[model samples]
Target chain A: MKSLIVVMALSIATLVGLVCMRVQATQSGKNQESAVSQSTISSDSNSELAQGAPANPQTSSDSGRSLVLVASLTVFVLSVFVGFEIIAKVPPTLHTPLMSGSNAISGITVVGAIIAAGYKETGIGSFFGMVAIVLAMINVVGGFLVTHRMLLMFKKR
Target chain B: MNALVPLLYLVASVLFIVGLKVMSLPRTAVRGNLLGALGMLLAILTTIFDRGVTGYLFIAIGLIAGTVIGTLMAKNVAMTAMPQMVGMLNGLGGGASVLVAFSDLLNTSDHHVDTLIAVGLSGLIGAVTFWGSLVAYAKLEEWPQFKKPHSLPSQQLINAGLVGLNCLFIAILAFSHNSAIQIACYLGIAISGSFLGVFLVNPIGGADMPVVISLMNSYSGIAGAATGFVIDNNALIIAGALVGASGIILTQIMCKAMNRSLSNVLFGVMAGGGSAGNVDEIYANVRSTSPDDIAMILDGAQRVVFVPGYGMAVAQAQHAVRELSKVLEARGAVVEYAIHPVAGRMPGHMNVLLAEADVSYDKLKEMDEINPTLDSVDVAIVIGANDVVNPSARTDPKSPIAGMPIIDVDKCRTVIVIKRSLSPGFAGIPNPLFAMPNTLMYYADGQQAVLDIVKAVKAL
Candidate 1:
């Protein structure tokens, strides 16, 4: 019962955070558009308008980036709920495999690492990215294979 | 093609969820794992076509090298070393997150508040998980320096200070305009977070490893999710959240089984520090029995159950126990294993060991499942297990392990305990079960005792 309360509290907190971020993104989007339009028509403040006009694209992208954040947060929270519902049903016998299997899933960071490595933006960044790729892949491959090996051993008469 | 990539990622996320769902059942678990791997492969392949990913040579090299190393580790690890293996893998995953977050922070020109915060979180949590898991792995592997729980008088204070330092670093990183200063703050967060992790996990006792490992697993997942937010990838977010939730559930289960709270385990509070009854007084009536005597008891026993613990793993007696079970079955006796949730170093540790020895999964019953039926069993053979079967948990309210859920092995008609000595369990409390009138002690190594019992039963 206490654990249930903790879970509910966590869910509520995550939802609230995501909702706030979504609202912030929408507001920022509106603000950026109004700023762009206002700067365009205010010809008397030419210097200010010139400086602000150049940053319009960047501000617009910032809002766009926030939208992406909102989307990702939505996915994260929903997947957490799905995880709770699905994982709760797993019996004790499979707990170890569940842990190792999920450990493999966390290796999804490898996707981010791959992009980082292949972007070639900075020499140090690529170096770290390549190392991250190796580490994440080890987690992916090792975690899954070990779990599979353990699962295969569970035979019934 | 670009649209198809997101669609593929969506498909991969769904596959991961479906795979975890399928893993709930034993029969479909193997297929479920394969499906997860398939999803992973799909996600990786799809990422290769991502725009701006031009350095294919490095990616190929990393993939090949990682695969070779991962496969060898997976193939060569013994079942007994599973906890260590999982810990090591968790550390690698976390370490990877730290690197990815650092790389992204360095490469991206966009210093958005949200992105910087996410980057800070990814670095902090990832570094903590990596360092903490390495400590856990070393403890499990029984490194001499870490074999015993190490604690200082100001351990918690030190840990709190580190956490404060990390948070300060993260905040500076988030609001800082200078990239160089931002990078330094990020490094500060990682370094402080690493020390925080080490300090937090260092003092925890060996018996609390299951909870610690589960918590570390959750941290790794959360770190991955933070990295996902940094990279703005839904696939990573989804997968990381699933793992995070799964680890939380497992940690909750472990804590419940031990009747301890998460905080209790984390703060290194020894379970039930209440004054236990005197050791000599508790074991005064303890009766000793030999293998022949145990065999004679088993000869006429109609129902028998074996309770195993970490000591069984130490003795490597799983195969011997299986042999004994087979012999008992041939003699028309029922044999089943009563598995306690926190029995070995990790959750489900004993079950994996028994599975490796070809024991049928059906014969393994959970603590709750077998407790009610223990009264009807003719004999309960406790092979190296102690605390789980201790009657004090139920009878002695003042005992250290009071209120903890334990197998009611003492309720059986006859109880046979195979152990080397009367030493206390990880809880360091004397067990009154050893002194019960119906309980008989068979003093020997777990494997030797089981093998002797098999030989004696055959001779009978």
Candidate 2:
């Protein structure tokens, strides 16, 4: 229990740190708008040909990449905390539906699969991406529908 | 329109969280599921409209095919087969993550060290989750080859070796600048991770499937999160982390319910270690009865508690059990179900089966909730359940299931166990509860026995 408290406190600290970092990044990004306009222009010019380029540049500097990583990690850790708190309140009776519902949520990978499949280059990459999209769509559709079916059964007398 | 993408994603994320929060209660759970589906729909639509997604042919085909298949599966699956259904879905989710990571790796020409590491981790964990979930599905479906636990020589050593190989590949993939070397290392990591998954889950017995499935669910989530990192998507990371956390909590709950450590369950060493020599001694006073006799006892009972297990699921006796409970309740006998945490092939298995039979969720009492009131129960009908009701859990320290929490049905005035034979349960140990002076065993299929008792009770 003490350890749980410590972990909670640590996570809260991390959350604060992440929020501060995001604020700083946004402020800095606004200040550097003119300075980075050249790089932005170059990326926009490449975007037409590159087709499936990521939001950030592939050759992002070390600090830029690390910032993205840190932001992503922050979201991951905080979301986990939210998951634990909400899911722990679920009774044993709803365990199955909770599992199937959350299983459906993991199908969020479909978003990534979509980008991969719909990328302009239609070749081996698109082929595998299409397959991934199909698989993820199945997970999303089947998982949600099945969970709904099961939940519909937990009725009153 | 470009600014709306992140805003819409944020909405979807909030919807997902609200959906899960509202699902804590049965009355609101159905709506909660629908809300979650809405979030998924929103996220999918937003992604489709996002910049760089210029091609739509493959997306259209994939979505149509997936919807058709998914609808059929959701509509046609039997309640008894839910464990395998969930297992299959986990495997597919993991499989999708692996392909997403692969496609991301191929599409990007330049790679940052962090993105490369994330890609490697996603491939490894996703491949492991996919194969491990398939093995779990096969085991749960009771495939002939997987009916019994199988272990290779020095299984742990082999698993460790596979982990080492995967780590080495991930390191090389992260450091390597050559596209060919990176791709090769990625494939190598996936292959080794697949083997590690199979080997890790293969030796676990059927009784530990709940833990295995939950852990796999967690792995699938972590894999998705890794893919999120690879692609730099906040929605994917948040959703995946939520699932990862949910699975971990469920796995911990299951392990605690069985009074076994996670490592003990994973090692698959819990079986065949019971005190078999005392079986005859324990069964010396075992008493047998008929359905009519059980009905006679039930006729005078004021309160009854029904304990259902995996055997109830095996016989598909939930409806019959519900019928019996209705008959008992009509006669002024208070009827309630006592559900153990790890009752069936998965967590909440019995509740789902019973709920399908029109049994109200409110009537279902958890083990900790019902155990104290069991002594007041005039009749405890343990249908197709064994280890959960075994008194040895409380009495015998040397027993494999000792220290595990049980239903304490033995404390009731009369205990009626409906089973086919004097056979032991998954634990493979004789239950002294069957031999207690107040206990009576009725031999028949769970559904048949319940039907017979219902008929006899109606006649009485």
Candidate 3:
């Protein structure tokens, strides 16, 4: 538990450093729009986000467990609908880029990958986790950039 | 902070939806891309804060290395090679899910039935998607000599058997308590699933590559969704579902363009159909025209349409074609480009090619829009397109491409087909449109032919 706290502290420090760099970059008029958005979102949720700490399952009741599962299922079903509706209207001319673009979005698994890799110190587990992180990051970065490059070529009248 | 995490995730999901919505149009696509990227950033930050994740050293390394490599690859890939790049990215997504599920199973002290089921699915789908996408990349790049369709005897039976074996292994892994036994079962499931993926994609002909790639992409999304269930991550689940749904819709669109069902694409090779008969017999009555003659025809024509295909992409003729169109327009001809949905190797491939050549998006008409008035078109210039414009889809129900939606370029007053030879198209089927009296085949490479036509038109 102590090691876990130390790890978290280190990560917090790193995140702070990144935020500072982002602020500097933005001041210099670099393309740091994402930094601005990130700061805005973080500031809005700064207090409550820390309150939503991980709850140990040992103390949670069975009803709580079931409720979590139910909530997740609801989210899943609703997301499926949201996905179908949004993509249904995509023009045939944009299908390939869209596929690749959303492909990058699915790389959200990198979030899972980071937890898997860093949550434990076991050799085998960490190794697999690191591999996952790398692969998912590649998908995330490459897919979006490629989609952006392709979409930029298209011109309107 | 905890309450804020879900709210942030919800915001991120909405951004993704908006991004996709805006991406449907050419005008807002770049902004849409930015929105999606912003969503990703927000989601990643939320995960970090909510989970209170540690071990920054490795995370920093992986993130930096991946960003650098992925960015370089995205920047360097030529437009023609975009499909393979997409294939690689899809495979990586699947591979990541597989690893995540494997790690989750390893770390969990108590495996609930639901979690086990989710992990099992993650492993199975991820394995298939990974291997299948690799084969797709190989086929697209023609990296290995084994590009030809290779099917085992009783292929469907074998595929079904592999699937059954994989399911049984998953069941054993989930139910068994012995760590040793569970590990063995896990390995078994992965191996069988990987082989199944290879078998599934190996026999699919190159003509169906677009559908196969899209299907694999969907599998990767399903795998990610399964991983989300295992880890109980709302953002992952939402993102995965979005990709999966969109990919399925795209795959369906590809199948419809080719007049093929998904099942037909997966197992069509079992029939072992031969390539459409000899080109010699089909091209015997075809008349050949020179650039000068085509130029002469175009000089007097008022309504002209240019139909481009994969051949134009291969010869890099889009710019030349654009120039030829400009010259025709200068000669008082109302020139337009007709794009078949499945004209190029990938979906919207031809559009990207034409757009790169500075062709105005407004002047490019879809098959449905252009086909209706084809009869009124004075000159239809077909550059390296065959099957999509083939009249076989209309006249011969027995043809392989019959029922497929093709541009009705054959109905024009004069159809000028610019190709290197009388060779068949990617489908390996001879186009009977070449034999029509109104059609004149200009035997030349696509880029060279268009340039020649431009020169000849200038002289006229």
lDDT (tens digit, per residue) of candidate 3 on A1-157: 4423433443343334334434443453432332332211122122222343221223223344444556566666666666777788887778778888998998988888877776534456667888888999999999899888888887444
Which candidate do you rate higher for DockQ, 1 or 3? 1
Quote the positional error of residue B424 for candidate 3 in Å. 1.5
Which candidate leads the pack in TM-score?
Answer: 2
- Compose the digit string of candidate 3's lDDT tens values, residues B1-460: 3246556866786677778878888889888888999999898777666544566666777788888888998999988887888888988999898888887766553454566778888888999999999988898888665488888999999999999998898888777655556667777877888999899999987778889888887888888888888886667777888889888988898899999899999998523223545566677799998988988899899999999988898899999999998998888999999999888777777887788788988788889988889999999999978889988778878777778999998899999999888777766677888998899999888888899999999998
Which portions of model 3 show Cα errors greater than 4 Å? A1-63, B270-282
Model 3 interface CAPRI class: acceptable
TM-score of each: 0.91, 0.92, 0.88
Shift in Å, residue A42, candidate 1? 30
Runs of candidate 2 exceeding 4 Å displacement:
A1-60, B274-277
TM-score of chain B only, all predictions?
0.98, 0.98, 0.96
Question: lDDT tens digits, residues B359-449, model 2?
Answer: 9998999999999898899999898889888888898898899999999999999999999988998888888899999999898999888
Under CAPRI classification, how is model 2 graded? acceptable
Could you tell me which 10 consecutive residues in candidate 2 chain B have the lowest summed lDDT? Answer: B1-10
**Roughly what TM-score does model 1 have, to 2 decimal places?**
0.91
Best by DockQ: 2
> In terms of TM-score, which candidate is stronger, 1 or 2?
2
List the global CA lDDT of all models.
Answer: 0.83, 0.83, 0.78
